[model samples]
Target: MTNAMQLNLTTPGSNLTSYIATANSIPMLTAEEEHALAVDLQENGNLDAARRLILPHLRFVIHVARGYAGYGLQQADLIQEGNIGLMKAVKRFDPSVGVRLVSFAVHWIRAEMHEFILRNWRIVKVATTKAQRKLFFNLRKSKTRLGWFSHEQVQTVANELGVKPETVLEMESRLSGRDVGFDGYQDDDDDSFAYAPAAYLQDVSEEPARVLEAADWSAHNEERLTQAISTLDERSQDILASRWLSEEKTTLHELADKYGISAERIRQLEKAAMQKLRSALMD
Candidate 1:
């Protein structure tokens, strides 16, 4: 009997309306029949019994999927996910549990639908943590009016959902926000395009004008430094170069040895040169 019923069962496909009608047309099983099929699948792993168990519950999956229509996802996709949950529930159904398949399967069905919504609802995921997910589904339903939640409402939702008011507010903000293109839309006018993130959030380092200005400023400072260094006497120039400019910089004692002078005298000369350079550059 189960094999004949399985042969008659048709899975949902691209034609959603037709699939839904077929699902609704399938007969609901009596408690005895449901139990027998569940026992067959659980004990003997009968695929035929599993098919019979799942086929009749397709309408229930459709019913459950309808509640998630506001998530801006395709109805067909949600129904398909719910159908998978129905199959999983059938595979795990225990005949001795003394509960109908629908009751047992509701959790599995909603779980799949919830997962699907979380994945496809937005480009960026809104709810990641367990608490956020709980708040995500329940917060909207908790609202009495349309606009942003008042302090009292936030507190009420937080208390009821066992989360902080701040968390509730954060999720509300996420839900109310919309995804925007960084470059903006193709049909956007000048006014709208000017407001896009790409317009203002720019890399000044990459700008031609800024890059040219930075280069010119650096060149000017280098020119000034060269002139400043030129004002020092030849010996002072050599001392400064040896002490500061050289890659393998000389120590004060090393410069003193080359100059045939005490290290303290070399230090004083180097300091005087640096002071003259500073004064020239400032002028």
Candidate 2:
């Protein structure tokens, strides 16, 4: 069997025979060696000792990272991130606390994996806030079956997590839905895996009556605007042009300078012009 296949056969994260055999052929550390190395790294910041302590834990990080495979990140990359977290935990470890390095590092490992998963969960993240993060991780487990979470099951989870039922339901809906391809290739048939946004999302164009109504309303508004513009004095029209219709609309100060008036006077004129336009449009 290949080395990779052989590696896969062993329990993940615990036995690093493949890595050990490949990297140094060193035996796994005893509890004494492990503690001593952790203490050395923790106290003196010995990077080499830290590397030795963390190398064996690489397999463990891979094991935890594996659980997040559904996120679709490369396993190697996830393991790399988890290894970084493990190294950080080792650096900050308090050996006097009487906890094994593994126990302390597990949080760091999972934290890294969680970050990887969150970042890679979707092209656009499905989770944003802290509660959403919790929901994102727990909602799948919250499911009692493959299809949907029943109301009671949702309530139970909501109570356990101390979140509102509506929040739980919204998250559940998001989880149940999936990302789909926007469009298929040219050769795609009816059975092809395309999900055009036009097909699934609300199509405003589909309602011809609404479309016609919108068009008519827009045309009517334009007519009213033209009529209003016709009614303005030549000076007012010119001021409106430079002030409102230009590529870079003139500021009140600029308009005041041009019209030889205070900025506040310019603002009043602009407001009056807008009010007339509104009245004309309403009519």
How close is every model to the real structure, measured as TM-score?
0.42, 0.37
Q: Which pairs, if any, clash in model 2?
A: 13-59
- Model 1 residue runs over 4 Å out of place are 1-11, 124-283
Span of 10 residues, lowest total lDDT, candidate 2 = 181-190
Residue range with the least summed lDDT across 10 consecutive positions in model 1: 184-193
Which of the numbered candidates is closest to the native, going by highest TM-score?
1
In model 2, state the lDDT of residue 283. 75
Alpha carbon lDDT at 253, candidate 2: 89
How well is each residue in 128-147 modelled by candidate 1, as lDDT tens digits?
66656677878767764545
Model 2 misplaced regions, further than 4 Å: 1-26, 124-283
Which candidate has the top score in lDDT? Answer: 1
Clashing pairs in 1: none
